[model samples]
Target chain A: MTPRLAWRLLPPLAVAALLVAAWQAWVTLAAVPAYIVPSPRLVAHTLVADRALLAASLGITLGVALQALAVALVVGVLVAIAFAQSRWIEASFYPYAVLLQVTPIVAIAPLVIIWVKDTHVALVLCAAVVALFPVIANTTLGLRSVDPGLRDLFRLNRATRWQTLTRLAIPSALPYFFGGLRVATGLALIGAVVAEFVAGTGGQGAGLAYQILMAGIQLNVPRLFAALVLIAAAGVVLFSCASLLAWLALRHWHESELPPR
Target chain B: MSAAPVLAVDAVGHTFPSGTTALTGVSLAIADGEFVALLGPSGCGKTTLLSLLAGLAAPTAGSIAWWGEPLPPPGRPFGYVFQAPTLMPWARVAANVRLPLELRGSDRATAQRAALAALARVGLAEFADAWPRELSGGMRMRASIARALVASPLLLLLDEPFAALDEFARNRLDDELSHWWRDAGFTAVFVTHSIQEAVFLATRVVVMAARPGRVIADLAIDAPFPRGPAWRASPAFATLCADISRRVAAAAERAA
Candidate 1:
């Protein structure tokens, strides 16, 4: 990596190391029971020892989040475009969209699980619902935020509605859309975990949330800590993926992505 | 002046929904190949008039004819340069210049060629790949002009396109615009609050008054083609400027 990138990575890694060291020192000095607060070494040991079970669970949770995010991106953007096509349509549906967002996922997840027999699909649907609003809201604002002069230029050229949206509005909406996507990705992960907890599916295809739930009941604190660690890691990785995509798509002209002049 | 005018605005009037009158009894017939400047102070409805001429809005009273047809929804293939450069920040200069043709359903290759040619005309061919932010303010304005000229428009409308630039950049653009008009022989209606810019570029200056803008004086420059720095430094230029300045001051008095 370049020196600039090295600088960025080093500071975060150093802080993490310091936190781990502090945690271990406290655990050793206080002689705390591992069930109450596992030492950093014990958590690391449990992470390796339970790798197979934890890895499978991690795969399921992350898979659900990713699928939900993908579904949300497609549906949300199309909905936002439809909103742009007519103010009447936007006025009618926008409030319900806000309602979907404002209602907590846990409140609705149980109802969704009961209604949809296929638990996995229901989980994905629940996660997608939570992730959908930002893309729609941000993209709608971006579509409306067109420069007035540019709008006139399009009108002057007699651009068709399709031409205006694809050539002008879509490109204009991208930075804002990516911004929404970043937020949506994190929400998708949180929603996925929440839905899995509510679903309580435990047999062969149990997710990390199920593992975390079981570990807490069994009081296998290190295993619970391991599952929590995997979730945190997954959230960071997913968030970074979104950031990288935003930078790649927008580095050419977007102010947020552009190098300083 | 030509026997048949390109644009005829006959006793046009406009009132916003809020009941502010923007234009009143505004009649103008712009002949083919004439560079007309709409000179007035702020709130004089110069922009509203231009928007109307372009069929961006319909007048509340009266009518307009473009190339002998009743105003708009019939394609006249005109270009408009807004007060701001208004290039799409996301697009390269070439793509931005090609926008009109692309909107007209021209094939990509043809539009790209026309874009490059237009950029060459505006001395921006080399900068066609640059983003709008990569360009200086004057260069960005040049790209805006190239976009306007790319499709070989019949009429060009400018709304104080250079007003934001420094004096040097503004004068340079004015110089290039004058040359482009001379060589291409297209109809142009330029809107500006600057008396000097109006005097320097327009074949005829249509001085307008505020408190519901109406034409105050229409004076033809009667100067030869391709006026340059020599013309600008001459006593003739100063005389014309002084005359136009007096009319503009009278407009400010009326508005007050």
Candidate 2:
């Protein structure tokens, strides 16, 4: 990285470090009760002690979320292409998609569990639905929003519809697709956890949500804080991965990925 | 002169769905290898006529034909450049130039070679991998031209391609474009508001009246090819510009 960009990044890094240090100091200085507010050191100890359990739960959550996200990416993009092809299809189906987006996933998770009759499948379906809309909306908008002049230029070249869609529309939609994916990555995680929360864990094993609930019930505040930290870390990892994918896909040509110099 | 016309615009007219008429009973014919300029005031249907000729839009009345074959399917017979560079922002300069070839199912290697050749023609080969955002306005326009030229279409339609450029860039591009057209041997229909530009680039200038656009005058420049700055300062060049300017002013007055 250039010195300027490195320098610019320092302030945020320093602030985050300061916040962590302050949190550690405050928790230690107060001699807070573990149930009320576990110290960072205690949380760390709980994490190491319950390493096996935490790793298993994290594996389960990650597996479910990634499966749902994969499904959403495929189905959402296909549906978006279908919508882009025909105004009538867009008119008929887009509102239902909006309906799905607006409807609360928490309210629907139990219903999905009951309907699907398989815990893992139900969880994946609910998470997929939660993560699917942004991809559809963004990709569709990108596909249809091409410059008329460019479209004309393509037409004048005798480009087939498929060629136009694949060569022009899809590439044009990529940034938007990645934009949706970034949003959906976080949503997929939340949906997986919430589905597990509502559906009472099954399939492979319990997830982080179950651990949190169990820790809360047992009044193991250190474990609870540890689970919470794991969840936050998982979220950060998901966001970073999604952001990295976006940067990789767009960095060479797109303005969004231009590196500071 | 003895053979069939390369392009024929037969009593073409256009009225938007909003019920505003842009052209009325406009007609013209262009020979093969001709460079024709559609010159007029703003809103005089010069672009409308070019669009009709390019098959971007069908004339509400009358027909346009190419070499006795009706204009191919609204988009196949010609290449077009809009007033704006209109390069896709997401693509690199090479990718932008390769668009038409890629659309036509050219393989990556073939497309890359063609894009490189076209970019070299326009002196932008070095910036091929750079994104559109990185290019200056003139370089972007050159890329647009390279794209239009890459397909090797019979007809080239330019809608004020240099209207937005600085005077230096515009004049330089005009000289370059004239040379390219002479060498490429393609029929060109350029639209512009500048009388001097029309005189400088075109063999024939078709001046139009405003609102419900109609041809008011057609003047032949009769200038030699590869016109340089010296030609711009020549007495004959000024006479042609002044004559076209007078006709354009008269057309504007009649519309008012």
Candidate 3:
């Protein structure tokens, strides 16, 4: 990174460090009980001690989140393309997409878990449902937002339907699709954890939410905090991956991805 | 210029579905390689007439024929430049220029070469890989013109393509466009609201009035090729401009 970027990032890092120091100091000074609120040191110690267990659970959760994200992206983009192709289809089906969006995933998770039978599959479905809306909404808007003059130019050139869709509609929709991907990644993580909480699935294939639940029930506040941190880190990693994909696809030409000139 | 006309507009008229009469019984005959300027006020249907000539839309009344046939069957026969440079922002200049050829099923290498050649013609060869947002307004317009010319169109239709540019840029582009039209030997129908531009560039100026737009005067400019600053300052140029201006003003007044 450049010196300017390092300098820009320093303030946030410093503030977070200061906040952690204050938390540690307060815990030590107040003689706070571990079951109530663990010190930063205790939480760090617990994180190291429980690394194998937490890491296994994190792998399971991350797997679910990634699978959910993949499904959401593919299904959402296909649905958006369908909507773009026909007004009749869009009018008939768009209401159901909106319905899915407005319905709370927590309320829907129980039904999904019951119907799917397999806990991992249920968790993926729940997360996918939560992540799908942004992709459909943004991609649909982008596909329909082609410049009118460009559309006319295409018509004048006698472009076939396939040509118009592939050349014009798809390229136009890319930035919006990437925007949706960034949003969907975070939502997928949330959805995965929430689905795990609802299912109460545990043991060898248990996700991080199960570890968190077990830690809380046993009053192991330090381990709970450690699991929370891992979940937050996973969310950040997913977001960064999406952003990197977007930048790689659009850095050369797209307005949203262009560097300052 | 010739007895056998390339295209004929026989009392063509257009009425929008909104009940607005954009053009009414307008007629003109364009010969091969003639640069005809359609000069009129806003809402005078000059653009509508150009669209008709390009076969972008059919005339609601009367007929427009290309080479005495029905608009010469829809393929890449003509190029049109709009008032704004309507380039796809996602594509590089070369890709944008190659769009017409790509749509018509040209191989990638052939289209790329043709696109580069077109860009070179418009002096944008070096910037072929540059994005549209990276180009200046005048450069973007040049790229747009390059895109239009990539197919080596027989008839070029321009609807006030340089109206958004500054005076110096407009003048320079006008000169360049005239030269390109001359070298390519293509029939051009230019639509503009600028009297000076019409006077400077056209072989003949067709003046129209608003409110059911129709031609009021068709004046032949007998000036020779390669018109310059000297021609713009010439007595003949002044006389022709004044005469056309007077007629346009009179038409506007009569409409009002």
Candidate 4:
């Protein structure tokens, strides 16, 4: 990495280290019960011991989240494009999309589970619904919000609607699409966990949610902390990956991704 | 000389939906290779008339034709440079300049070569990879002009393209644009409020009246090509500027 990037990465890395140190020290100094908040070292040990189970559960959860994200991206972009092209379609469906967004995922996940029957299907559906709004909203806004002068220039050049969208609107919407994806990445993970929590399933019992619950019920605090750590790590990894992708795509051109002086 | 006029605006008029009349009975005929400046006060519909010629907006009355053909769909007939440099912020200078060619379905290599040549024409060949934000205002305008000229347009329409620049930058661009116009030999219809700019760059300056714009006078500059600062200090230059300024003041007064 360049010195500029290394300098930027340093502060966040330091903060994370500080947080881990604080957690370890607090657990030891306060004589806190492991069942309440396991020491960072104990959590690390538990994670190593339960690697097979933890890895399996993490794989399942990641799979579900990724599938949901893919669905959200495809459907959300199609919907956004529809809204961009037709005022009538936008008027009819945009409010319904807003309704979907405002409706609580936890409240609706159980109903989706009941309706879908299959646990994986239910999880994917719930996650997709939860993540759909941002992509649609951001992409649509980007499509419609082109500079008027550029629009005129394009029009004067005899650019067709498809030409405008592919050459201009879609490229313009890229930052916004990635903005939505960053938000949706976390939401997809949350949706998978929430759906698994609501709809208990057996036979390779789906994802980290089941493992977390089992750890809690068995009074295995270190294991519970390990599972929680995995979830948090997954979220951080997703966020960092999404942010990196955005930076890579926009770094050369967009102001948002410009390296510091 | 026997060819049809490159662009003809036949008694065109327009009014906004809010009931504000922008133009009334504005007629102009531009031959191929002609450079015309529409000089007027702000809100005099000079830009609006250019928009009509560009086919961005339909005239409320009468019509505009290109080379005896009715204006092709709003975007196909001419290239336009707005007052602001409307380079896409997310695109590289090369990508921004290549937009018109891309829209026209040219292959990437062909587009890249044309875009590079156009950038070289505007002295921005070195900055092709830079983003719009990285460039100075004059550089951005150069990119905009490069984009306009890349398609080898039949007609180039500009709306006060240099009005925002400082005197030094503006005058330099004026010289560059005049050179480009002379060599490229495209019909140019430039709209500017500056009497100096009108006289310096145009073969003919069409003075416009304000508030429902109408052409008040059409004065031929009859100056030689590659007009420099020395030309600006010449007696003929002063006479034309003074005459146009007087006409503009009279038009503004009539509107008031």
- Interface DockQ of each model: 0.89, 0.66, 0.70, 0.73
Candidate 2: residue B253 Cα off by (Å):
1.8
In model 1, which residue pairs have backbone atoms overlapping below 3 Å? Answer: none
Cα lDDT, model 3, residue B26: 92
lDDT of 2 by residue, A103-219 (tens): 999999888999997788999999999999998999999888777887888777777988889878888888888999989999999988898899878445799888888888999
* Winning model by TM-score: 1
Residues B26-62 of candidate 2 have per-residue lDDT tens digits of 8899999889999998998899898888777888998
**Per-residue lDDT of candidate 1, residues A137-180 (tens digit):** 99998888888889889988988999889988998899999999
Prediction 3: B-chain TM-score:
0.96
**Candidate 3 wrongly placed segments (more than 4 Å):** A4-8, B1-4
Give the Å shift of residue A122 in candidate 3: 1.5
lDDT of 1 by residue, B11-89 (tens): 9999999999989999999999999999988888999999999889999999998877785634558889998899999
Residue pairs of candidate 4 with colliding backbone atoms: A155-B75, A156-B75, A157-B75, A158-B75, A158-B76
In model 2, which runs have C-alpha deviations exceeding 4 angstroms?
A1-9, A202-204, B73-77
Listed for each candidate, the true contacts retained, as a fraction, are 0.94, 0.70, 0.70, 0.82
Q: Candidate 4 chain A, which ten residues in sequence have the lowest lDDT sum?
A: A198-207
**Candidate that beats the other on DockQ, 2 or 3, i.e. the better one:** 3
Local lDDT at A158 for model 1: 89
Residue-level lDDT tens digits of model 4 in A60-115: 88888889999999999999999999899999999999999999988998899888
Candidate 3 at B4: error in angstroms?
6.6
lDDT of each: 0.92, 0.88, 0.91, 0.88
